[model samples]
Each structure stands twice: as structure tokens, then as C-alpha cells.
Target: MSPASDPNARSLVQAGFSSDPPVSNPVALRAYRLARLRAELRARDYAGLLVTDPINIRYATGTSNMQVWALHNAVRYAFVPTEGPVVLFDFHGGLHLSAGIETVAEVRPALSWFYFIAGAQAPERAALWAREIADLLRAEGGGNRRLAVDKCEPLGVDALRREGVEIRDGQEVCERARAIKSPDEVIAMRRSVAVAEEGMAKMQAVLTPGMTENELWSHLHQVNIARGGEWIETRLLASGRRSNPWFQECSDKPIAAGELVSFDTDLIGPDGLCADISRSFLCGQVTATVEQKRLYGLAREQIEANIALLRPGLRFAELAERSWRLPETCRPNRYSVIAHGVGLCDEYPHCGYVEDNDRGGGYDGVFSAGMTICMESYIGEEGGDEGVKLEEQLLITETGVERLSRFPYEEVLMPSRWL
Candidate 1:
């Protein structure tokens, strides 16, 4: 039986979420996203954008096919002319994928010149690929040769340049366009968050002593795929000592009772939105350790303090200055960024810490309403036994911020839950 239909799965389901909710208004969502990308292109005076990144393609054309495979192999792409139609060059035999997407004006078989596909004739194949793109730009651009490209191989860039097509960074255009989400996009994100939380609950329910870290992490992937969600971006669940020096992917070590278990759900859920929530839970049925509570409490404090700073028009630097200061013991292993934007995946406008600025790890930007940000915190002293990670997905609004992720923290670990 499907997880949604299974009795045990039903019992673990969160109170407010639906396993398969009614489909959202795709028409409005697609229209809003396409318009946003076009506006960004127009603002930069680019003739068009060559969207090879699968995430950007989904944003522009609303066509998702083999997204995980396409991430490493650029087998499909889309082109959005600044003021014209969107043309999708899909993977082999994938024409039907975008048939119902109103924003996609045309679909064609993609030409891949990557080494694996073209072998010794890669150069020749790249030229052929460049020729088609140049012709499309000339026909739609009205003498404008400036084209923004999100990503491409050096051979492809050279080939396009040979065709007199000027290439600029299209990632900026895509990122800026994707920053301020439309109403329908927010609706889609809400669904993604709910699905992720449900998976989290399942993981917690089955979590027990002697369960390998991999076994616990697999529940998340199983729930996601079973519920029509996509992939988990990272294997970040760790128990006990492994949790201290963060960024360690899960392993085979058996979790012990009362030990701290930390996980980051870089989980891509429904509609390709990420429910990037993190939490540390006490393993097995035992009263939490004082040390565990201390670490978890600090992480929660950091997340809450940072999340409270989110508001429209707040500068990135000012946020770094005002963000909660990690104590000296925990400072060395702090999370790389205080927060980051989240949508189809972990996105742009990363909020960096003050220390990052000294080493050129920071940039200046301003928060805007309609942008969804993930507040992140990781607190573990350099030589500590276990670490705690806590994050919240939030939506920046006209007035302040709204917490998009509703997964509750560990009552044993948290001194007091934040309302």
C-alpha cells in the first residue's frame, strides 16, 4: 500500500498536512514565473536567456524531467527571449513533457555535445548546437546579440562566441527574478513544506537505538518519492560525535540512547520547492542530557534571534552585524551563513556573518517582501561531543516574517518552544 493509504503512515502524518492535496493553480503559477524571468531579462537589456540549469528551466517553462540526472548532465534546456516566446530543447524523446505548459511556445530535441555524447566529434556537435541558438537569437532579437547564459561548457561558450553571440552571466537574471515570489509560488512552497514536515515526523517516529544513520535517512527519501516529491539534496543526518564537526554526511554508526541526532532537510518536495528545515532530536526514549539541552538551546536561540531580524529593506551587512553572536566556543564551527534564500532549491541572497566579511565571504543585498528565506543555526564547540542544528523556513512579508516551516523542535532539547 502507498504511504498515504497505509495505516501506520496515516498515524504518523502531521495534523495539518495532506499527503496529496488538490493541485494548485498551475496556470497562474506558470504565468507569474515566466513573467518574472522575462522582466529580469528586460531589466538587464539582454536579448534572451539560455536556461540550462534544470531548476531555471522549471522556473521558466514549468517542465520537469529527470531533474536529478539533468543536474550533472546538461541534457535539456530552455530559451526565453526577453519579450518573446519560450523554446524548450528537451532530452531525447521528451517532447511530450512540456506539451501542456502554456508558457513553452515550442519544444525541440536537445543537441548535446558533451564528451559522453559526442566523443571525438564534440567540437562539431557543439558548433551545431551553437548554430541553432544563434539563429533563434538573431530571429527574435532584432540585431541584439547579447545573450545571458546560466551555465555552459567552455567549448559551448567558444562555439557560441564564434557565432557572434555575446554571452553574459544569466544566473544573476534568474536569481533576481526568482527572489521575489508571486502569490501562486508561495502557495506551491507551502505544499512543499508540509510534505517535508510529514517526512520528518516519519523519521522521528521510527527513530530508535541500533538503527543505522543511513536507515534513518532513508525514511525521508522514501516518503518524498512516495508522495510525488523529488530528491534530498544532502545526507546530513548524524548522531553523537559525528554531529559536532558538521557537514558530515550520514554513515553506518548505530545511534545510542539519549545521544543527540541532528539532521538538515535539504529535502526538495512537491512543486520542486525545498523545505530546508533542520532540528536536533534526542534518540530513543530517554530523558535528554543537560549537555544536549544546552547545545540545542543555543542553536534554537541563534535561529530565533536571526529570524526576528528578517524584514523588508534590511541590508545584508546590517543583518550580519545584528545577528546573534555565537559564543567563542561555538564560533569556530558556526554555519557558513546565517541564512539563505530558498525556493526550487537553496537559492541566492545568502546572509553571511560578520567574520565572513573580513575574508571576502560576504556581499551586500537587501531583503524584499515575497522572498522566502531559511534561517540557519549550528552550535557546537570545537571539541564538543555532539552538535545541534536548527533552522526554520520563513517568508518575508510586507510587515515582517512568517514561519513557513512548522516542524516542532524537540521538547526535551528545547528549554522552551518559541511561539
Candidate 2:
């Protein structure tokens, strides 16, 4: 049984979120993804795209065999011609053993890079892989002799070049295609968010003084994987002093009552999309101090202010120009970007700080409908201890933006004046 259908797979399921919209059909979702990618390749005038980045390969072909292993080693690859079926180069006959769920036309055994067993040379392996790719390009009617490649080792690139193939930047091709979410992509993200928030709820219920940061983080990982989600991207969970500078990740430090805990969930969920959300939690059932409330309020304000600025037709530069200005006391410790695009995993169009733009170099892209973005904020006083981090995922619609994240804020952390 699928994880969603298995009764024993999920240890707990909570049901308080009613505001989330219905998800689109998964079958249609996969189709939409392929169409978008093809459009991107055609627009860029590429003969074909060679995707070696595991995530890009998954995006193009919808297969996840040895994806984790591929992250560190270039074992598998996928080839998508401008107008033909996707050809996946599976390592160690994984394609033969796996089910063909996506739009794959062919699966060929990849040239193994593991040379230890037979004392195989690296040059020979590279040449063999390049010859196979060249054959595919010729068969696919590659006229321009230019093939876009996302990731490849130097030897492999050299081999391709020797085969009369000019390698172009294929990472941009995938990133541009994935920047805008189709209705079905949005639904997948919502499902991911639903599971992530449920994990958050579980953590909230059991949070108390003396709980180790590792113990608290386990709740999130357990629930995520239990609900068909894949591994998390980062270990960004910390408490008290560790939360101040940010990016501390989960540690063995014990939680203290009245101390603040912050976490960011970069979880790759059910459909390979990420549910990136951060929340600052107040440990135990103690009233937050005045300083703590002030910091949380400031971070919350920054998050909300940037999210409000999200809309179709807005340019990244303008958004950065109009981003929330940190007070002089907190400017030094402010996060670099107010927000960034999110799809498969922090995709593209990073909206950076106004200061960055003022220095004459920053990303610039017009906001379009169907783009999902994450608004981020980290407010910590320099030289002072403790900080509050907040982030929310949003879906850009034709008219406005929808908050995709459903995690609740720590009410006790709110400043009395704001309350």
C-alpha cells in the first residue's frame, strides 16, 4: 500500500487545517511538468538537455533511483531531446529494476564509474558515456551541435566536446522551467505542507524543558518520512543561545524553559518538492521576557511585510528596494534576502537586500503568476544573545498571493503592545 493509504505508516494524523485548497490530480501534474520543461528547451534553442543533477533528472524524467547516491557521485544521467522521449542512463541497471512511471522512452545502463573492482580507467568510462550520448544526439536529429548540460565532471565534459558537442548551461533551463508552478505542482507542495505542519503540531504537543534538540528534531523527521516524504535538506533546529546567530542546526543541547527554539524545515516531501518553513517556538509554558517578545515581533513584522509585497508583475529589484528596512540596532544581523522562489527546492530568482542592489549587483526577475516563494527573516541583535527566525511559503496567484504554510506562530512570543 502507498504511504498515504497505509494505516500503520503514519503514527499520528492531526486535522485542524481547513483553509488549504484542494490538490490537483497527480497524473495531470506529471504531464504538466514535462510540457513545461520541453517548452523551456525549445525556447532556449537547445538540441537536447543532458541532466546529471539528481533533482533536474527527476524533474525531467520523474525517476528517483539512487537519487541520494547521485548527489555525491555522478552515477546516473537523463537525456531529453527537444521533441523526443526522455532517455535515462541508469546506474547498475536501476532502470531495469524500477517501474516506469514517468515519460521515459528508453533506459540504458550507465557506464559505471566504480573502477576499483576491475582497475578500469576513468578516461575509458568517460569516453564510453560520451559515445552513447553522441549517438543519442545524432539519432535525435541534433542539428545545432549544442547540447545543454546541467552537471558533469570535467572528463565527461571534455569527452562530450571531443564528440563534437558544445555543452551549454542546462541548469538555467531546468530552473526557469521550474520557477512557475502549475496547479498540480501547487497541490503537491500543499500536500507536503500538510504533512510538515502535522509534524510541527506533534512537536508542539511534546515540547518541554530538558528535551534535547535532537529529540525534538526527530519528531519532524519521523512524521515526514512516515507520510511518504523523503529526507530533510538541513538540520536547522536549535534552542536558546544556539538560536541567536541562526543556522546552528539541531544539536544535543537541552531545551530550557522560557528559552526560544527556532527551526527551518527544508524537507523534500512526497513528490520531491520541498516544504520550506521556519518557526520560532517558546520552550515549555513560560512567559517570554520583554526582550524576547521584541525580537520575535520584529522578525514577524519583517516576514509579513515582505510577503505583503508579493504580487504578479512585481520586479525582484523593486521588491528588494521596497523590502522591510531593519532598524539600525538590528541591521548588522539581518538576513541577506527578504524572500526567494521555491519549487523543487529553493529554485531561483532570489530577491536580495536593498543594500545588495545598491552595490550594483542583484538578481532581477519579474514576478509571474504560479510562482511559489518563501519569505524569510532573521532578527538578532549583534553581540546580544538569542534571536527569532520566521519564514512562510506563498503561492502567487493571478490576483494575489496565497499563504501555503499553515504552521501557527507562538502566541506567547508576541509583544504585549502588538497583542
Q: Which candidate achieves the best TM-score against the true structure?
A: 1
C-alpha TM-score for every candidate: 0.96, 0.92
Q: Write the per-residue lDDT of candidate 2 for residues 1-419, one digit (tens) a residue.
A: 32234453322332445323476676677677788888987887888899988898888877777667788777788889988878888887586743656678788887754444224588887888898898888888457777999988787889999999988999999999989898888888888888788777777767889999999999889888887888889999889899878778898999999889888888887788888999889987688898999999999888888888889999998888888889887877777678888887887878888776666436888999999999999988987689888899999999989998967677899876557
Candidate 2 C-alpha error for residue 120, in Å: 5.5
lDDT of 2: 0.82
Q: Global CA lDDT of candidate 1, please?
A: 0.88
Error of 2 at 132 (Å): 0.7
Q: Per-residue alpha-carbon lDDT of model 1 for 220-267, expressed as tens digits? A: 898888777899999999999999999999999999998888999998
Question: What local lDDT does model 2 show for residue 48?
Answer: 89
Superposed Cα RMSD, model 1: 2.1
